[model samples]
Target: MADEKGENPVTVMVVDDHPMWRDGVSRDLEAAGFTVSATAEGVESARRRAAAVQPAVVLMDMNLPDGNGADATTAVLEVSPKSKVLVLSASAERDDVLDAVKAGASGYLVKSASVAELLEAVRATFDGQAVFTPGLAGLVLGEYRRMSTAPADDRAPELPRLTDRETEVLRLVAKGLSAKQIATRLSLSHRTVENHVQATLRKLQLANRVELTRYAIEQGLE
Candidate 1:
């Protein structure tokens, strides 16, 4: 398997200042069938290791010894443009979350997330989807809305028409339902649900589910 950038899939770099916490999370990810390819503490180390390994996903912490996750995210991506960053932090402050997103993080998850939830978020993030904790998705969306700089017309993109099934799938996707859950809800197979999702993405000209979810929210489906 490969990521959107064609990097090896499930290969991750865990970035946190705390050794024990980082090691524990690395173990959990390894147990869940992911490859913990690299580990780093603080901003500089993260930047260096990410450049060297270019892992498919970067698991970042908000507060590092040298800088915050946002700083590290920007630096790492600058060096390894193909890396996908997912902030797994203890902080949920509005500014911190916004900063990380603005710095190009694919998603944000709080430390309180279960091991299962964290693993799933990592998978979604690597899939180029916007994975956030329960309430934080809404928070980030609303914040982006408030901080919009584009003209109103530019922000309101003209959407392409979608089939009824595709529309149903899009709504579930905007609500952050996984493909499996959508399949169960609509009495369709998972592959069928994914087909609908891919069809919708093609119709909308969206690159990934992250953009698809944002478009759905703009259309009041979220």
Candidate 2:
């Protein structure tokens, strides 16, 4: 059932400066059927291991040695385009959250999340959706709305915008369907599903599937 819905186990990278936290995260994900492809502490190690493993998603900490997690997000994304970074921090500060998003994080989650919530977030991230914990989603959307209303600054032209088909694809994405699974459900080929995903990303100006998920939620697409 899970595989059919594209809920198959995902490959993940866990990055935290705390050893116990890392171990706990790894254990939780593993128990939930995901493979912990790699584990790293601090900035340099996270960057190096993320490049090496190229996992589908990265669980990152906001504070790290050598650099901030936001900084690490940029480096990891550069090396692994398929990977989405989700900030797991103790902070609920708007500055910290916005900083991580600006640095290319797909989502920001407070460390208070339950194992179930973490599992869902990781799966959602894998499925091309951003999965922020409860309160943070509003913060992100409010920021985007504010930015949209801001004076014409140097920001790039608005993204192309999602087509009707693309919107449907995104809805399915939120349901945790992989490209292949989504294709089967929609009676399209896997390549077509991939194309739709890529188009959605382009339209939303998201770096990866994780941000795409968040965008869908913010826009009430799903």
Candidate 3:
């Protein structure tokens, strides 16, 4: 983890099949003060480079040479459980987004993302805040809401309900507050905010911060 002053550089790995996009993003991130630890063009290469670099975060393209980003995400998680994965892809189709989440991505962004937004996404992902393209956020949340309303008997009964406190935390999350910022606002410890976030995810049957952010936005938490 980097220092609280935001001057300490966070190590990052860039995974994309296109050399142009990969190199451009790497240069952008480097200019933003994040250390570019490694760059890879496919799932296999990503796995190997991730292992060698042990980056704090990874910016991955959805389509790769050897395998898709979803496959690479699973591999990277296996090798670096603590490293945050942010999917930077062009596809916003329901299946691709959901599959990437299932494979353990902390956030999702389309390739059209501006350099500023990409930098913000990386920081947000590291701080345990989920991110998604503004347009796709609704689609993802609507899908979840639709799925969340299916036959009661089809799913678990004790669908963990969010405590009021957790809902408050969710609101802050949707507003792009980092865990530390949320804690400060709530007058709680940072770890407490993180705990609420985890508990909220469990209750909502969501995968990570990205999903949580989408849901919160749909529910007008922001």
Please tell me which model should have the higher TM-score, number 1 or number 2: 1
What tens digits encode model 1's per-residue C-alpha lDDT throughout 1-222? 355555655799999999999999999988877889899998999889998988989999999989899999999999998888999999998788778877888788999999989988898888777788888767765666665666776675555888889988987886688899999999999999999988988888888887787666556454
Estimate the overall C-alpha local distance difference test score of candidate 1. Answer: 0.85
For model 3, residues 51-142, the per-residue Cα lDDT tens digits are: 88888899988899788999999999888888889999988887787778778787789988888899988987877667778756556556
Deviation from native of the Cα of residue 121 in model 1, angstroms: 2.7
lDDT of 2 by residue, 197-221 (tens): 9888876677766556656544544
CA lDDT of each candidate? 0.85, 0.78, 0.82
Segments of candidate 3 deviating more than 4 angstroms: 5-8, 168-222
| lDDT for residue 157 in candidate 1, whole number 0-100 | 57
TM-score, per-candidate, Cα-based:
0.75, 0.69, 0.77
Worst 10 residues of 1 by lDDT: 1-10
Q: Ten consecutive residues with minimal summed lDDT in candidate 3?
A: 213-222
- Candidate 3 residue 192 Cα shift, in angstroms, is 12
* Candidates sorted on TM-score, descending: 3, 1, 2
lDDT (C-alpha) at residue 55 in model 2: 86
Top candidate when judged by TM-score against the true structure: 3
